[model samples]
Target: MLTTRIRNVDTDAQADAGMQSLNEPDFKALVDSHPKAIMLTAQDGSIAYVNDQFERVTGYRQEEIVGHNPSILSSGMHSREFYIDMWQSLERDKRWEGLIWNRRKNGETYPQWLNIYPVEHEGGAFYTGVFMDVGELTANDERLAALAYYDPLTELPNRTLFQEFLKARACQREPADRCFAVLFIDLDFFKSVNDLHGHDYGDRVLKQAAVCIQGVLRKGDLVARLSGDEFAAIVELQEPSEINAVCERMASAFRKPVSVDFREYFLSASVGAALYPRHAESASDLLLKADRAMYAAKTAGRACYRVYSAEESEQGQHQQMLSEALVASLKVAPEEFSVMYQPQYDLRSGAMVGMEALMRWRHPELGAVSPGEFVPLAEQRGLIHELTEQLVRCITRDLTRHDFGTHGNMRLAINISARQIADDRLEVLLEPFFTRLQLAGWCPELEITETHLMNLSPRCLDKLRDFGKRGVMVAIDDFGTGYSSLAYLHALPVHVLKIDRQFVQRLGPDSRDSRIVSAILGIADALELEVVAEGIETEAQKAKLQELNCHRGQGFLMARPTPLESLVRQATSG
Candidate 1:
């Protein structure tokens, strides 16, 4: 009888007598060339052999590491239990792959997505381990994580992270525990701080603010930066009666003066608190309740706190529902919703120079919803971008029907918000919206608020310049209200400035107002740009403004915001 024997390749290779003659040298070369760190270890976790990849990764030579334990490079990040579990899993014929923070030979700690696989002999014994570095890629992954959760400037958790924290807080409740409250904090006059001290200083102020707030907050509480000068905090209460104490603690945090760049300045922030279970059951409801309370606090006076009242909660919900409905209606019921053209009257001609396309919501149940209420709601909910696109389409259609501008062309002044300006895809999205219009020589003026220009992104500046070069008119609305007018005016591509209504309203007995008006008109004259004054409620205001050399005026004195149909008639006759 003839006996046939098949030897285990790894066992034979080690002896240089079994399959080592056929496969050992080839396997060794393959392991050395592999991108992953490859190593063979004994059952006691002692290093038997390591590939060149391991040497390159660990900065340790084979001879130095061969007799050493695998823990020679231990960073001590994982607990003893972690190693025990890992060893047991491998012993049980399992593999492990996950993200780990490890220190390098240079003492630089970095994130790594490591994949460790168990290589076994024919008898089911753990033999070798292979792991990919993935450190550089994991570093990028951490950057994305930071971008997702935290504000880069202030280094505070952003809105998304705040919401998650709030949700987690709400979930951690006993049956009879005191309800949690989410405080929405907003800095008073922060925009002016940015304008005066400049953005870099303003950013420092925000960072200091985060530090100050965190210093006052109780342990385990979350204070997150929601948006510009806005913060949200989830506070746990021992009892419902202690809610005011929590609010007082927050108010006291800002009561003291804060110093930035060695300049001591005192500031206060308005806070609005909405209690979970007591005020709201849902995250959206809680946020709305807090926001409405914040607005109420601002209305009463800044630098205070307001708890969400029953009435405020109801009103906020009603408004939220209305906004959602209006957004849906605008998309579906275009026939019902129509644009009323507010005439931008030219002082010289005393006729319409341009008409601003204002959106009006013809609510089926609530009669006509005014732009004053719904427009802002749209802005808060990010529905304004859609509304702006609608205006673009409608304005383009009207311009195609009529010649608007210097000759036969008339310009349509469309109001754009800060969100639209900051949106990087504004230009790309406009392409498809206007591709169908194809309105030649119909230049529409995009009027953005003075406040929108401050602390704007460089991408927005580039977008505005691109629009200017494309023959689109850019106008600065409510120009006198913002202090950055003179500075940002040069930075921005502006073709027009609409004088603030406050300036136009004070023309009767206010010489200071007259001086302001005069200075603005003189500047406009020097700049050779068109100027329009808003809120001409009286003949005196209109006449005074025109005498100041104001190029255009719009108010109840001329005509209110009229429907486009009536405006077309008004424009056609003039």
Candidate 2:
């Protein structure tokens, strides 16, 4: 059921109706009326006639194009070889259909779908080409590419594009001729900002950070956003000597405050780096090594950078193995993990007021593994949440069994990590545990490090405030060790400040630390906050603290961390 329409086509029917052959006027009328951009060319490639569509699409008039070569539309996008091959195909097959970039009379370049057919007529043989603009399709393809390989927020290269670029660079270059470095950067306290303000604010910060990073890098270098608060870069190095300066430059850029939405935020980054061929042979391995080094920088207390070493690589692998074993241990035998309470005493009363619950792990082969060694690794490996949950459950169970609350109603202190604070489920995780561990209304105090507090976002603060409303006490641990500002200190809802062990260990008759401790104690007194001195192993330190009017303290000299039974017995007997 196809219908046919015969217009001005130069067919046999047209010859039978009055025209013996197509004259110049008939050809011109037909070509001009055609919808497509049709062009008639001589066998020598000279233009003969053009349709109205051709004049409109190419911005060329019939007189301007009729006698000249079609090379006037050449855009220079295709090379000589391309045109030569195209002409060869047309000559061999007598037709050509392909995509081409052409120049218009208005000096603009555009893409077109072109079809050329060779035909022999009464006067001569000519090639007739018909083309349609395909510019929108080309633009759509580019947009799709951008969406596929670029981050929408920052407009930077994302992980997928980064991996492809790394692979390309790795394969195309000779290892000996050039060396490249992969740097992994993790922004400190970024989670707190994201949680406090809003994701929109966090996005603004990330985009600004990306710009800052790009500003510090060289022209050929590539920067990419790997994930949340984490970015990676590929730096082309002329020599190994250039890496230190480059890393330093990168770290210094964030030293300036980033202003977004009328709020200024200070950012510190931990940068880890690995070089090409020396540290790894593959792109994935290079990135992994850089990540390991970056975590090492974070462990070194952040706001720093570290270069990958063979020793660190070995340690990283060992840490990974330990992390796997730790995960398995959580499920197989939960009882193997234990929490010991370290007694904190009132200096004036000579009685225990509270106990800090410290987590201890015992591996069958590794013996007793210190919390310092595995805690950060667990945090990095995304095991901190699980570890914290397990610890809370264990401690609550032990507290109920000991009935320490009934004996003396002493407060319990547990450490909380930054990751835990940033977790949206933190309140949900601890609610049931707190409900079970209820010793009337005596709430356990949660000890958060100073760094964790300074970095807490509004959301985290809100969560902390919720805990406070439930009678939970918030204590800042290792008080003087982090970047705490008066602005935050005045607004933070905190109960206790634990003086860092370093300042306490140096306490003496007239040492500089004595004055520092005095100043910290004075600050605490002014703020009406209770102070606790940590790491007191000597009587002199305790006497000095007492002399300074610091009433509460904890140390190995008083009593080493012990199990629930021992702690309960001590509390009952004394």
Candidate 3:
């Protein structure tokens, strides 16, 4: 008594016109011959039809299941929340597919791969479910467990499995015998690899890095990919000296370049370690301390390792207090923040051609907070956008009040962070500031760090190109300090390169720094980019730069950073 509701079509007229269409009986025959079990139900969940395969698979005849709901086959193995989630997906996405356990007519439960989708007919809406028995597919539990607990890209243990291992190892053993260390590994400049090359290339790099790291560890050690470009390892050591030896091996692993499709990438890691029963007692605390130490390694130049220390914990707490204070100050007393200008000079002409805008904050209780300390905190707290907006407002107001006189058309440079560049609203935020600069006949320049410039997203690069089209100049600050590839420099819309103070201060004829500066100037000349020598404190350094044909310079020797009022008065008097 199996039946299907079919739409009324003109078979007689179609035959006269020599057209072919399947009648209801033919459609039913096709369904009966399908290899997989198929069931049709009404919108109200009452079973309407079952194919031959469905009868064979479930051991149920059509007559007995016609009026019953599919819930009759539910094996009670899944929770209510599981069914809720499945239905939510069906309602929102209009289809669902997963594995489920169902009871057969013989009262035996088995796993089945099920797919449910909605169908519309002339009669009404209907639900069709197609399923297959998957008990044999999951018979190999180790393979199934691998899918559940391992990262597919690197074929390493995932964070969930790593945590389970850590907890069992630390808690199951006696406190005295818990003598293992946790190392947090973060790949340095991995984002640049992903940004410069496509994600496929980056994936290969990650796979190779995983192999390199795992090859160095002992058989009992465990390595897991915590997240993107971040990994963790569990190493057992007999003495503290063993920790250094293991970390050095891990650092050496990345020294060799990773080659992917004929392109070579130099990769490195920042490692931080924390020992059990020493730095921390619990697994979670050990992991956290290790992560903090890893960040310290990054701060102290990457490709290195640091063990957890009490002083680092104190610094972390102090940073947290500063972060909270910054949030409060931004909301209540924003006036404590201001902008100062440090003039840049023409080395040959000895005239002020431009000035860099520096952000300053004076906390009433803390006296003066360094930009290095709070700027990063603001970025971490997601308050950098607000800080940048405030900076622009202050610059606009101050410029409006003080006239530059003879230095009217000078270039005004402002520092831009990577987060600000990635923000979609950066254009709108700077539109008014751009207009103000245009009205004053002053040129606006954006100064970005060399490291950030190499890691900019494609969309951010497009935004920078658009800014260039709008007449905003782009300069790479602290040149030669970061791992910038020549290809990126050539591809970027760069107008100037500012030599870092580290190299400029050591500018002697026979010194390596002098040779580096010379090489930088040569590259700039070949690229048609201007060069600015920073930290020109001594006359000898200035003369050396001038002899090398470097034109622009900025340092304490030329002029110190001054308030807007003082800067205007000094320029007018000079």
Candidate 4:
């Protein structure tokens, strides 16, 4: 029996009245009859009665729980404001349906969905709370192989999952409701955690991060892990001001350091957010814009957030389409992808020396894409080798029409990369060009950049050596970019050091530039390799090369890079 007090709720009554039931209806028994925990509390929040379900959930007997303040069940999960607000609602009208968490007698805690209502009589008012175990909700959530589309650690949706979620969510929105927002969260420098402590530890850091994030969430908000080091959330708001409040709270919650493995670690996230219906009508549009906004946050430096704008997203989509088109262009007929030869000339004699076969693509949609643009893109997309193969075939074909054979025998140089040097089948790939064009001694020079030389493996070095033995001339395209590259000149199978344009730009009055150019020439002279001063646009820069005994150069001073046919005409005319 619960002690009953009909009078206004008092401190002494609140403290002791729970010991004796005032013949109050056996509501606790009703709760026990059903299978979930139930409790009856007086107007002041002291437990007056508890059902057997409550005892089982909290590991306390009815007696142990009775007469105690309901605070015994508090697991420090809810804020002081949470309890204050719940009671305030009871004092006013009463009836709150939501979830709360509490600790068991043994100290383990779990969540419960609660329905609290005011029990009023002619005598006084009381609160009755009925709670069901939500353990199963999360249980089934975890056991179900959680759609492969989600990032498991954060329970955040992956990109594929996000796209599907966005699509479904977008269709649900009405034209009038344009208030929902999508946020993309990226863990800044998260790779360093994996590199320094191993991925296992990195996974823990990420999971811990998720728990901290959950602390800031309001009801009806959905947060999903987008991918490794990236998280996404959908904030459903009825008003625009709510967006700022939600984002600010979420960003600030990351202020305290994360505790992992008995150590404190600091981590920050960059958040890119976009409003639904406002920024995009389609799923891909929403995601693409959010991604750009995230990149903006990252670019601005970490621990920041940016909202997506329509214009930014459109520009990003345009770039994606362009990049996609550039990739598709490469698969067309070989004739669509052509080479433009830039003629290198002998400075003293003013006669054309050799030609550098530069790549050009007359893409169907995007016409006349340059090598500088597509080459970097291809390298990233790992299409450089295929592009190079196409180049070899083109150069081999163009050699037949070259009138440069009249000017003391000139060769065409084609650029290659570290990727080409590592391939054992590279020589095999070149055999077609060599055999088809009858690769005579030094018929084509293979050009490589400073980066290619620095990254070369021993197998790659051996491959370059093999090319040298096969009468393939190798030239280091840019000389002074990487450290000790000049030192590696002889060890490399290179026959030419194309002085990077940096030295030539300063040649007019700077003796420092002149000396640097002179030093490079002396090194090349000692190594018995040729030196070509690149980007010699001024006649003064060109005549200075003659003074330094540098024999060859290429730049606008000779002529802007011309097509192979024009290159043949110019070299032959000279």
Measured by TM-score, the strongest candidate is 2
Please give the CA lDDT of all the candidate structures. Answer: 0.69, 0.78, 0.80, 0.70
Instruction: Count steric clashes of candidate 2.
Output: 1
Instruction: Name the regions of candidate 1 deviating beyond 4 angstroms.
Output: 1-216, 219-305, 397-407, 431-440, 570-574
lDDT of 4 by residue, 1-574 (tens): 1122233565655434443443446743455687667877776656767787777777889778866777777766454555666666655775765556667889887656667876654344567777755543332364236334446566554565456446545655244744788777777757657876899999999999887666777666667776787777777888655766766666666667779989776788777777777777666777767788876665555577778866655655555565677667667667777777778888779777777888878876678776766786676455777888788777767766663455454766888877666655667787667555434434667888976687777778888887778666788887877665556666887888889998898896567989988988899888998888889889899888999999789998887877667766754666
Q: Report the number of clashing residue pairs per model.
A: 7, 1, 0, 9
* 122-228 per-residue lDDT for model 3 (tens digits): 43456788887644333234554533556778877778667756754565344364478999999887876787688988999998888888988997788899999
- How many residue pairs clash in model 4? 9
Q: Looking at model 2, which ten-residue stretch has the lowest summed lDDT?
A: 1-10
Which residue pairs overlap in candidate 4's backbone?
1-21, 2-20, 2-21, 2-22, 3-20, 3-21, 156-224, 156-225, 157-225
Give the per-residue lDDT digits (tens) of candidate 2, residues 348-371: 888888888899889887788889
List the lowest-lDDT window of 10 residues for candidate 4.
1-10
* Each prediction's TM-score versus the true structure: 0.54, 0.64, 0.57, 0.57
When 2 and 3 are scored with lDDT, the better candidate is 3
Q: Write the per-residue lDDT of candidate 1 for residues 95-187, one digit (tens) a residue.
A: 654434455567654434444555544333334556544433222345545335557666666786566545434444346766677888887
Residue 293's lDDT within candidate 4 is 81
In candidate 2 the C-alpha lDDT for residue 358 amounts to: 91
> Ten residues in a row with the worst lDDT in model 3?
14-23
Model 3: residues with Cα > 4 Å off, grouped in runs: 1-178, 182-271, 280-288, 301-305, 327-333, 376-386, 455-459, 482-491, 508-526, 547-549
Ranking by TM-score: 2, 3, 4, 1
Q: Whole-model lDDT, candidate 4?
A: 0.70
